[model samples]
Target: MATYIIGDIHGCYDELQSLLTQAQFNQNTDELWFTGDLITRGPKSLETLRFIKGLGDTAKIVLGNHDLHLLSINEGIFPNHKKDNLTPIFEAPDCNTLLTWLRFQPLMRRHPAFKFALVHAGVYPRWSLKKAEKLAKEIEVQLQSENYKQLLIDMYGGAPCSWSNNLTGIKRMRFIINAFTRMRYCLPDGSLDFKNKLSPEQTNNANLTPWYEAITLKPNRSILFGHWASLMGKVNKSNIYGLDTGCVWGNSLTMLRWEDKKYFSVPSTIK
Candidate 1:
């Protein structure tokens, strides 16, 4: 049984199928671990969601920022971002089912057998893998509770930049979600820097660094994640893999076979 880890899909269904074909994926014997952003941006969000949801136990998906945004918009929490083009998904007949499945996805996962960590964005530089797993569960509990909508409503904002044990209520939850789903660059002091989305070298800010650069914990384990498409297909260090090949931006979709570290990719139809 082969295990493949795919990059951010962002609703590019055709490209996903092509990648699977290239990888010779076997639904009966292979398992897929998606880095998330399963829907949004591309033309077939509904179909993409349905395809992944249908995989059931054969697939594992973590939540990405776009996935959370879809849930927030559906729950009447956050209005759609003005630049977002998610009309097809919002208008689809199975929108409810899609959103339900998305909300149920975890923010983080760890496979001891593979000695790898999977998350939508990346882990905070300040926390250990164990700490990240615990925090992920805390948010998962709230997301599955009756107050989930209320939590989603307050899940925005960039404040409380630094982590503090004293932070509670909505502020705490929002911080955790941001770190696990939207984080990229961070301040030297370990605070999140949400404004810079450009490539690391392109930025003039001297006080910030990429999250992976700042991470000091579990130096032995590798982390696999998406969200920073500008990195192209870089696996910065042997222990880190940045798999967002910009599929939604007309680039190729990527997948990494964990066992042998072989990669497979397929050009996207978007553009």
Candidate 2:
């Protein structure tokens, strides 16, 4: 059985279907590992959620920033952006089930057999695999709890850019979330550069580095992630695989076959 790791879907349901078809995905035997951002931006958020939900045990999805935003908006903690266009998902009959499933999804995943780590964005360069998983679980617990809405209410705002053992409460949570979801370039001192969304060289900031470039992870292990579409499907170092092909922005959708390192893609219909 093959295991395919797909990039951010971002509500491009048709493109997802096309990529699966191109990959010849087998629902019964093959497993799908989604890097997240399963909803928002594109036109078919509701359909995308339902289709993935239908996969049941065949699929593993991590939570992305967009996924968290959906939860916050649903709970009235954050105002919905005019560009989001997620009303159909909120009003869908299966909204509760889908949201429940989404809320329960973990922020980081590790597969010892494959010696790979999967996350929506990327792990902090300084964090060991075990530490990253542990920190992710801390936030995951809050997202799964009864006080989840309260946590979401305080989820925004950025500070405490560098890691601190003494950090607690919402500040700590925001740091973890940003590292796992929204991160791209960061200062050498580990302050998140939230405004630098361009390619690494285009940013004109010499002190900044992509998370993958900040440190050397184990040579034998790999990190597969999404969320930086400007990289344009670059895998960068051999140990890191970036799968965000910018489907929501009229680029392609990407998927990687983990065992064989095979790549498959489908052109976007958005434009």
Clashes of each: 0, 0
Model 2, 1-271: lDDT tens digits are 9999999999999999999999899999999999999999899999999999899989988999999999999988878886887989888888898899999999999876898999998988878988999999999999999989988888787676788878898889989998999988779777787777888756777888988888578888889999999988675698899999999999999999998999999999999
Least well predicted 10-residue stretch by lDDT in candidate 2: 194-203
**Candidate 1 clashing pairs?**
none
- Which candidate comes out best when scored by TM-score? 2
Best by lDDT: 2
* Candidate 1 global CA lDDT score: 0.87
Which sections of candidate 1 miss by over 4 Å? 80-85, 217-220
Q: How well does candidate 1 match the true structure in TM-score terms? A: 0.95
lDDT of each candidate versus the true structure = 0.87, 0.90
**Tens digit of per-residue lDDT, candidate 1, span 61-168:** 999988888888888776776356677778888887777777888999887688799998899988989899999999999998888898888888898788987889
Candidate 2: clashing pairs of residues: none
